[model samples]
Target: MPVYDQERAGGHPGRPLIQNQTVRIVVIYAIFGLAWIYGSDHIIDLLIDDKGMLLQIAVAKGFVFILCTATLLYILINRLLGQLAAADRGRLENLENLSQKNAQLRLFFESAPASLAMFDRDMRYMEVSRRWLSMYGLGERDIIGLSHYEVFPEIPEYWKECHRRGLAGETLREEAEEFRRADGSLQYVRWEIRPWYQAAGEVGGIVIFTEDITERKRFETALEANERFLRLLTDHLPGLVGYWNGDLTCGFANRPYRDWFGKNNDEIIGSTMRALLGEELFLQNEPHVRAVLAGEPQHFQRTLVKRDGETAYVWSHYIPDLVEGSVHGFYVLVSDVTELKRAETERQRLEHQLQQAQKMESVGRLAGGIAHDFNNLLTVIMGLAQLGMRELGAGHPTLVRLEGIQHAAEKSAALTSQLLGFARKQTIAPRALNLNGAVEEMLKMLKRLVGEDIDLAWNPGRDLWKVCMDPSQLDQILANLCVNARDAITDIGKITIETGNVSFDAEYCNAHFDFVPGEYVLLAVSDDGCGMDRETMAQIFEPFFSTKEIGRGTGLGLATVYGIVKQNNGFINTYSELGEGTTFKIYLPRHTEEGARPLPEAAPAPCHGGSETILLVEDEASILNVAVSLLTLQGYQVLPAAKPGDALELAQQHRDRIDLVITDVVMPDMNGRELVRRLLPFCPKVKCLYMSGYTANVIAHHGVLDQGVNFISKPFTMNDLAAKVRAVLDAKGEAVD
Candidate 1:
């Protein structure tokens, strides 16, 4: 039936050798028997003498021959028996070894972890392992002797072909298939079908080894779905997110990372960190990267310059990817904080500005108080000196000394005026005036002031907006700014004066606290000269805070400009860099109106005596005495009082008409405006001239002269008093109300 059985049954080398030995033995035995028979007969014939004796002798000899022949046959039979017994013992030993090997193979097949089975060439199961029966939900008795298709009728043709191939001497391994069992359960099986050969090299059967891989396949599917979800999450995040491997090569990058770096996913993935970030950036970040890879988390801020040369602030965090208590790689998260940083910077700037403003306000109040007290004393001193000068005629020797005293007092008064300006207490008379025309008029004076070496560049805007500010105040602003510009330049440089119409919006005003939203007249004075540092700029508007050498400056120039601008409801901004240049831009609210022709310049006021009856009220005794004497000498009837109550008494006693009342604005008994209000009930027809060392809110509103109110600043000489008194008496307007 089988090639191996046929070979063993006929003409085998060992069988032929055994046959030859048996034939030889048979021939030898036959020869020995023949010789014994013939030889014994001849011996019997020779040994016998008489017939009777010969018969007896022949019988004995024949018996002996027969015994010898029997002995030889017994020997041959014993040899044959011994040979057969040894052969039988060897055969029994071989059979016992084969049986032991078969038992071992059966144990191995049943104990296998994988489902293993053996089938004949006919595809019938020869044997099945316990694992195979368990895996396929079958019993060994049910599967053995059954064909594969018979055991599972739903087996696909591909699998059947695989079985056929195995039986045809082919070996198949690791073919995965979804196998449906008879019980209606499905299994993902990866199996190996190998043809097992007999000793003669012919395919006798096949051994199929199967593994259930359903769980493994399901796990792979879940893993893929999770990966896709993770990718989607990272891609949609606003921050730049990425993962790096142990080699510092990028394993994955989010959409932001790719877009920000101006690269695609394919270019970023698998690229080294150093390669993706240029060498400079890589070097900057190398330490952080190393630290993260060393299992330490890192967070820091960096400034990135974009392709358009714009700067951006980024906050980055590098978190190490820890696996099994060791570092595998790191994760990167980057967020743009440029706007946040800018807002913070702006906040700091505004805070500094507010502090400076508060400081200036405090200092200004102190300066104003000092100036007010000093002005009061100077008023008494100057008033007495003027009286002395008038009494001592031009021919008198002491008249020259009185004039000197008068000049010194006048200089002190000028200093006080500067203080008032810095304090924003000086009265201003505003009129709508074109700035361009004003600048043009100042061009000549500026040229002479800055000297020939310094170039003057004046670019005045056409159709400039009219500014409602005191013309004298404008002159002071321009003069002081030009002088400062001149002093800043150590060598030949240029001074530029530019005028333009500009507007500030709400956003700009929000950033700069002092700014307001309106159309403005922009006056910018620029100089290519030595600039101030931050410390100097911070104190620039403070009174007597000068950078110049001692005695070279009073430091009130810029302070006065600051006061004037603020009083006019304007803002000033400065831009400067050390050793580069400086620019001061003043923004004054524009006055919207049709341009008017310039007014005719009026001749200077002539000092003259006023004959009108006047009430003079002064808190200081010296000022009171001097003013009464000065007016008495000028042929005017003067009622003098040291306080408001005394003045009220004098006014009531004087039944005659008192043409005017000259009262100190700040007095101990009462303020001038209140005194005026009270005195007005007594003498309703009396006009009042309010005088103060410094302008006060009683007589003025926001350092501006109230309309129809007559006022004068103190520290006046006889000439100033004479001119003001005459002008007030001659005025053809309604009496002070």
Candidate 2:
């Protein structure tokens, strides 16, 4: 029999010993019974055969021995029952203790907050806590004994290697790992795996603890996306972009910003702004940046050097990038403004030049008006002088002196005409004329004007359209331009005059300022002479502004051409460069009915004086007296009035005697035409002769005389006035009023 230790069974040691004594008693009883049985059987047989009292006595003794042995066996049975009860009680106590310990361990593993799992050496799930099962969308029944592949089939190969490493006694603690769930969803987990150790310190299994880190992973992903977007935006931006930390250090810079600083990202990052841009430019911009970081928005201009060692001007804006309503850092945005500033300066210069030109033009008009009136007076004086000289003998010294005086007055008159042309007030009689024919007529004169060394060329286009312009003005324009070209040439050069009909379409018109789309007769003059610069070209149309030295050329030449061309509803363009030639193009509108010709010129005939009396009205008493004297000399009875009112009174007094009414066009009270209307009813047969020292409004307004009315420009000679008076009186005498 194997002896059991009572302490090991959780029972007292004395009870086990008492149980052993009872077992010893039961063993002695069994041994005695077997021996008595053997002896009784043999002795009983011998006593019966020999009839001996001793044999009967031995049999009875063996029975008594058997009875005693039965008694002892009963006692041994009782003791054996007690020892069996004690052993059963100790075994039951041990089972109860084990059940209590198991309940405590179950409570601990089931309620743990951390996801807990147990894996076998093969990386198969042996046990998993409730948290681990819930996390993986699994029940214990479905996951237990399942391989990692069965639970998560989509795990990456690297994850499998990690699992293997953990099972091989290597601990793995990865901060982030992606796990695919049974529902086909992904989870980010931060986990630690440690090998489970046996009592002997050998690896048995693996224990894993994991945490869900999906929100943190999402945050990181969003941060990366924003960074990538910012980088792409800055890469394609048009100007420099950068970021500065609170310490005025460069924290981030785009490609353009880095290039502007003559550095790369690595060289600029974490560097002070002063170090990147050098002390000069950095110090200049430092205050602005500091202001921005101090929560004030700042905008200013700065010049920065580029990687190619060139400087560029920029309009820069420094704005604070704020956090929690406080200045954190600064963001810089820059744009190039050099061209805009240059354009503004150029505009101001042009405005100043325009103002000067306007002032000179105004002065020229004033001087021209004065000269026009004075020239008319000189014409009268000169004509009188000529007449006096003719009356005197040619041998007389007084006649020669008078001739010299008349010549000087005539030259003064020509000067005044040029002045009037420059002022755009000169009388123009425009008619339709062929441009080709005009150029042909100018060729001879142009050749002489350009000098002997310079060649004159004409490229006249066939079938060129005719333009309506004054022929004399065209001649002057060509002469002035030729003279300018001659002066520009230092050596032998060529001047070309070209004429053609050009149709300006919309495209061409748009390119040329103030040009209209239409059929135009183009007159182009080009010269192979030293050309003028932009400054000279701008002032070339200004009166008194000339490149020629004193007395060589009048600055009024080009100004007169400009005024004439503009008055003709034409456009002029010039192209020239230094050391190159110059070209001037004059575009005049084409006239549709250019083939029509003017009526034949009437020959001047002798005016036959009549006995008819003439009533002459004049504003100036001297002109009225002079005219009366001249008409009396012509043998016409003259009645003169100093004013239109007096003239009307004279007409009424001699209604039948007054055959004609001669009056000044401009008067302080009534004009000549108005005076004529008033006198017409009183003396219906009277014809009118309108005269003025200035061109009458009726005649000069349209550059022509009114039909059936005679006009005499003032400062006329005595004979001119007499002839006009005689013609009016004679014509009225023939009329049957």
Candidate 3:
């Protein structure tokens, strides 16, 4: 046994309680026995008279002494035995109570809801809760005396250090740390280790409390990862995204939103809207903000000036984040639509231009149709007048009246020509002519037309490019433009005519609705006159739309100019503000090849008679009768057919080869070109003359006579018809046959 245990057993050192009581009884007996012997001897010596009597008294005293000693020893031993029995009983009771308390304490440890364990100072397990046992996978087993390290040999050095500190009376705690168990499995553990004290106020052992928090930690980790992923997604989106609290404080902003504010997330989050947007912008957006906060979603287009001073058009959507009918905040989604807006505007403008062009086309068709019929009537009237005056010779009685009728018909014919010009059906021959030369040639005549009240200035550009257009059409354009300019000048105004070579690019043409990307010859006429307003300028090219008094102006002037420009595949632009000068810019495509064919000289003055067989085909009876008479007056064999089919029948039956076939271009049965084509099989030697007032859908293409095809306009005088016939007969180039 240990030395302390031996001392406690009363073997080596001082004894107290039961042992002291035994010693006290032994001393008392020794003192009493000694004193009894001494006292009895003395008493006998003093009281006895004879020696023999003294001996007898001593024997009695010895008996008495034996009796007294026996009695005293009995009393003392019994009392001591009784005291020892009581001490043994009290010790047994204490042992029994301690055992009960220990059992209760063990029960408490086993039944605890928490995971717990108690260990002695030597790190041996004293008790363990059921939870601890289950948690560590330790089943029902007597492990009360097992060493902590032995029970779970995989304990880390750090945990061992914690345990040592706990044994040293230092309490240690760790929450949610990794714990690798003996089975190579992992756990997140929250634990505290502390020293348990003994009743003597000394450190007894250590107790550990632990909880497995793996599931909770896993939940937290997943939540964090999901938040990070959402943030990444929002940041990469193209549209601006942001969130705001009910207090108008910014809570979240994606990458585009952050960039727009010129701030990072850290700086932007929690900032007030007023601060980020600035006072003016906030004020502008305040109503929208209020609406969104009231749970009303808003979608609108807005124009904003950015921080960098760039203008931006945005389509914005504000969606309210409502919770149970109460506004929590709002989400913003904005997309830039500046380019789309521009494209839309351009599309509308182009549509408007298209509508205007279509309207003009319709009007031109009406005018061309009118001119076609009028020219037919005028042709017969003028032809008959010429034949009448010619057959009667000079200075006859009815000659003056015939001349008056001829003159009226000629004037009416000129009016129809203007209509044809405006209708874009005027027969024209285009040649590559330089704009500078054309303008120079028109200077003298334009000056005479504009009058002395206005100065006509011609500024021809250096190295002016050539344009392809009819020379007569150019003259008409110049004369009409000059006349309009002269009328606009009430008192004294200057008209400036200019020519230049210009190049247009795609970008410029995109902005200019009427332009194309190419080089052009520009003919500009500017007049510092009583300029036109926008309303007047818009209708300036419409036929019969005149600003002048009824007697002073034929509205066809500018209309004809517009038609001629359009007919040559060109565009025209006019710039004028009321009371400021007016300028008309005509852009004709540049002629790329060679110099133009020189303008033809005037036609021969008088008629040249021909005795050739002539087939005159006309749709109108009056025109056919007059044309046949005119040809017969010129001493030609005339075969006149009012209808195209009749003309074809006439050709088949005719014996001699026909010299010339003059046919109306647009007839009911056939066109002049078709008639000529049919006649070619029989009269292979015949020459052809195609005549029409307006040949919009006939032998001419866009009113322009085909190459090598003889053509004449209607309302011709006898001389005019004779000259054209003589020219056709004298020409070296044969007909289509």
| TM-score ranking, high to low | 2, 1, 3
Question: Relative to the unseen true structure, what is the C-alpha lDDT of residue 539 in candidate 2, on a scale of 0 to 100?
Answer: 80
Clashes of each: 0, 0, 0
**CA shift of 305, model 2, Å:** 9.9
Off-target runs (Cα >4 Å) in candidate 2 are 1-242, 245-361, 374-418, 440-457, 479-496, 505-513, 527-559, 574-583, 594-737
Better of 2 and 3 by lDDT: 3
Report model 2's TM-score to 2 decimal places: 0.45
Q: What would you estimate as the lDDT of candidate 3?
A: 0.79
lDDT tens digits, residue span 1-737, model 1:
11222334453324554676578667876786677667766775786556887778667867876797678668866776676677667656655766676676778787776778888888888777888888877754576788888877878788889898988988788746777867778778888988888877788888889988888878877999998898899889878899999998999898888888888988989999888888999999999989998999999999998767799999999999999989999999999888889999979977976787788788778878888898888889889989998888789999888888889988887777777789898656788989888888989998999899888887787778789987878878888898898999987877878787665555335545677766778888877678788878988987677999999899889989998899898988876657646778888988755575644432324567867899999997876877787678778999898999998888788735789999986666677877877887678888878876442221242223364578764444455577778888888867786
Model 1 has an lDDT value of 0.79
Superpose all Cα atoms of candidate 2 onto the true structure and report the RMSD in Å to 1 decimal. Answer: 30.6
TM-score of each: 0.38, 0.45, 0.35
Query: What's the lDDT of the predicted structure labeled candidate 2?
Result: 0.75
The local distance difference test score of each candidate is 0.79, 0.75, 0.79
From the highest lDDT down, the ranking of the candidates is 3, 1, 2
